[model samples]
Target chain A: MAYSDKVLDHYNNPRNVGSFDKSDPRVGTGMVGAPECGDVMKLQVKVNQETGIIEDAKFKTFGCGSAIASSSLATEWLRGKTVDQALEIKNTDIVNELSLPPVKIHCSVLAEDAIKAAITDYKKKQGVLTPEAVAVH
Target chain B: MPPLPRDYYGFFGFDRKLAIDSAALQKRFYELSRQWHPDRFGRKSAEEQEMALEATSILNDGYRTLKDPVKRAEYLLTQDGFPIAEQRGKDVPPELLEEVFELNMMLEEVKSGDESARPQLEQSRQHFLGLREGVDRELLREFQRHDESVEASPTSKQALQEIRGLLNRRRYIENLIRDVERALNPVTPSRPAPG
Candidate 1:
């Protein structure tokens, strides 16, 4: 399917396409693999520990155009936001923002999941378990 | 772990088979894809492009499941009135459980030993190779028996389940063997923790 103009723009010139200091206490990094496509994406967010605001977000993705667009849009949505606000940015929001087709909707969902995984990994490493992370499933 | 579509059967377009030619399956996938992929829709209307993408997606999912023998066996079990999941804590085949534990013990011993891990991994790999060959022989026998109606079958379903259980164990052993091989290879990543 022909991608939307927005999707094509992001694919052509992706933003924040790199990595950050994942080992830092205030930086959450998520590395996700799609076994279906053999694609791996790493996304990271640097948060202000005191104020819990994301100061920077970056990504390194190896996949098709939709995957790149999803990662770029996710990073754009995350910058300068509080952790709680970032958590609220759902897959549907990214999909709608990019106007992704149904076939590409999963790319958005995976990007959203990568964000949550990064945050959770940071919190786990820092040994500060938030209620969100520790709630009984 | 997501729910596979109820129409998964529609992808293969036939009742499942225990033994299939992997090459033939791949060839068929390529043929179906050539006929259905969205790239062919450049000259078609917009709606037609969408239809082509959806069809290709289904074809991809089907080929993925069938191309791997382990997954194909799991799909067969699901067809034969089994829950898709094995009970996590339940004991697998006793022989497999024993084999894994023994190999693991040997690996742990080899890890800090003076001798290189390469020799030990090679040794363990040879052992598992024998086990895989034996399992393959058994699986072939089971497949033949199922195919033959001449034998008065008293326990066909039971036999399939046993064969499925054996296949699951063989795959598990193969996975462990792969891990050991990776560890022995020169491409081993730095240890996760350093002093």
Candidate 2:
């Protein structure tokens, strides 16, 4: 199956593909995986504690091109955005942006899930109370 | 059209338990295959041939899935309408996180053609293989737990949940092993060797 041009671009030149100091109180790391596909994704975010803004974001994904592209797009959208605003970034938006086919839609869902999980971890580190139920795809 | 069996065990006419009689299952599979073989319907009408083809397809799929313990567990979960795939990251044991993280890092090194990482990758492969075997044992216990429960009762929920969790862990470990294998020997397409 051929990937969309955007998907291919992101896969070839994934942005912010690295890790942060996970021990830093300001940085939150979210590690996720899809059991069915054996894909693992780790998304990390450095947050500005006082302002609740995402100062930086990075991801490392072990999966297909679509998964790498989805998470790559996720980190790009995360930087400089407020945590609340980041939550507003939906899987559908990622899916549409990458023109992901029906089977690959779950890759976007995983991306969106990684974002939420990262934020949740950040909130926990900052000692902020968070909702018990975080979305999982 | 008659509705197909909801689970592989039912499809294969076996008892819904993990301790399946492999010899019997194999014999049954061959019998069904012969009955559904397309050649048996060669002189039949087109519609009959189509029906035979569909049945054969399902039969083959059922057999393949039922033959593997892990796949059988996954198939059962799928039949139960449990979003097994979606349960991915959420259901993994929290304690395995650190080990998984380290393994992923090693995988990266291997992927980058770092020969020095081979020993570490080999170690990780053995570790994950051991872990997967442990999970299989747990699955057997859970299977018995479920089988012993009263039929159509809610008491089986705990066993089912445990089985689901074990299956998730097993899947992750299997993937880790595959990664190690791929890195150790990168697959090259088969071609005629140059003289």
lDDT of 2 by residue, B1-195 (tens): 566564567768887765666788899999989988999999999988898888888898988888877787777766665546657466775457657767878888878778788998888888888998998889998888878887445757677777888887887788778777777778864467899
Number of the top-ranking candidate, with DockQ as the measure: 2
Residue A14 shift from truth in candidate 1, angstroms: 0.6
Question: What is the overall TM-score of model 1 with all chains considered together?
Answer: 0.49
Mark the regions of model 2 whose C-alpha exceeds 4 Å error after superposition.
A132-137, B1-13, B23-67, B80-88, B94-98, B187-195
User: Across residues A1-137, which tens digit of lDDT does each residue of candidate 1 receive?
Assistant: 89988889989999998777757888888765443343346789998988989999998776679888999989998998987788788889988888999977778877887788777777787788688774410
Provide the TM-score, chain A, model 1.
0.92
Question: Residue A124 of candidate 2: its Cα lDDT?
Answer: 78
Where is model 1 more than 4 Å wrong at Cα? A134-137, B1-68, B77-195
lDDT of 2 by residue, A21-137 (tens): 989999978877777787778899999988989999999998899999999999999999998888889999999999999999889988988888888888778887455425322
Each model's backbone clash number: 0, 0
Q: Least accurate stretch of 10 residues (summed lDDT) in model 2 chain A?
A: A128-137
